[model samples]
Target: MKPGIRPAHRPVVFRDKAADLASPTRSTMTGDRTVTWEDGTTYPMADVEISSASHPFHTGTARVLDTVGRVERFERRYGRGEAR
Candidate 1:
């Protein structure tokens, strides 16, 4: 490792706005806001839009797109033939 070239890494808190969840994790992300965890330790809080709490996969609410039906419709309208 080179000195003075590498950026400093520290612990930061990531807060998911959608899920209204917060967790302490080691990350290089920095934020102006700060929060104290349950242990009474303060760290930088970064607000995020998505997390496992709100994600479809983790919540078992994932939606599947109907691509097969769309393809069939397109083929019926335009015909599946090679164009020169």
Candidate 2:
């Protein structure tokens, strides 16, 4: 815990453009740009390509379908038998 040796943790606004979500958190990252948040307060903002709001794993929006179930459905529709 050396004084002035560690990076400073300050308020940062992480913006997820794809999800249109912005949240405030403390980080060592700094930004020259600022943005007015929903509360009408401006903070050092950083643009993120992906965040929990837009991330498939976090949002549970990942396209994960059951391939076996799909094949079964298709076979049932066309009659399950030897392929011709």
Candidate 3:
């Protein structure tokens, strides 16, 4: 362990535009913009494309892909000789 070898960790705000959410966290990342938190504290702003607030899984909006149909089509075309 050495002194002054670690990068500066500062307060940052990660904003999710789609969900209109902002979370304050400490990170070593830097940004050119700033944003105010709910507590009226200003911090470096980092725009994120997606977050738990807007993610399908987190929001329970995720849909199962149509894999069953694709599998049925493949089996019909290839013919499951051993199974049939």
Candidate 4:
């Protein structure tokens, strides 16, 4: 690690509006918004569309999307190609 070469990381708050969650951590990312934590601590706020807290996989809301059916259909349409 080179001194003074790495981007500076400051206290930041990542807010997931959909999940209504806020997390405080250090980051090199910046944002135009500012948010105050419950403890009265203020930090630069970054808005995110999805995070682990709200993502389908993490929240246990993920669906298989009929992958098996799709695969069967594909194989039916394009017979198994001869191994080259």
lDDT, model 1, position 47: 95
Q: What tens-digit string does per-residue lDDT give for candidate 2 at 1-84?
A: 678899889889998999988899999999989988778888999999999899999888788889999999999999788868
Clashes of 2: 0
| CA RMSD, predictions in order | 1.6, 6.7, 2.8, 1.7
lDDT of 1 by residue, 1-84 (tens): 777987678999999999999989998788999999899999999999999999999999999999999999999999998978
Residues 1-84, candidate 3: write the lDDT tens digits.
899999999999889989998888899999999977778888999999999999999999999999989999999999866955
User: Candidate 3 local accuracy as lDDT?
Assistant: 0.91
Off by over 4 Å in 2: 65-84
Quickly count the clashes in candidate 1.
0
Error of 3 at 5 (Å): 2.6
lDDT of 4 by residue, 1-84 (tens): 778999998999999988999999999999998988889987899999999999999999998799889989999999877988
- Which is superior by TM-score, 1 or 4? 1
Evaluated at residue 79, the lDDT of candidate 3 is 82
Q: Which ten residues in a row have the lowest lDDT in candidate 3?
A: 75-84
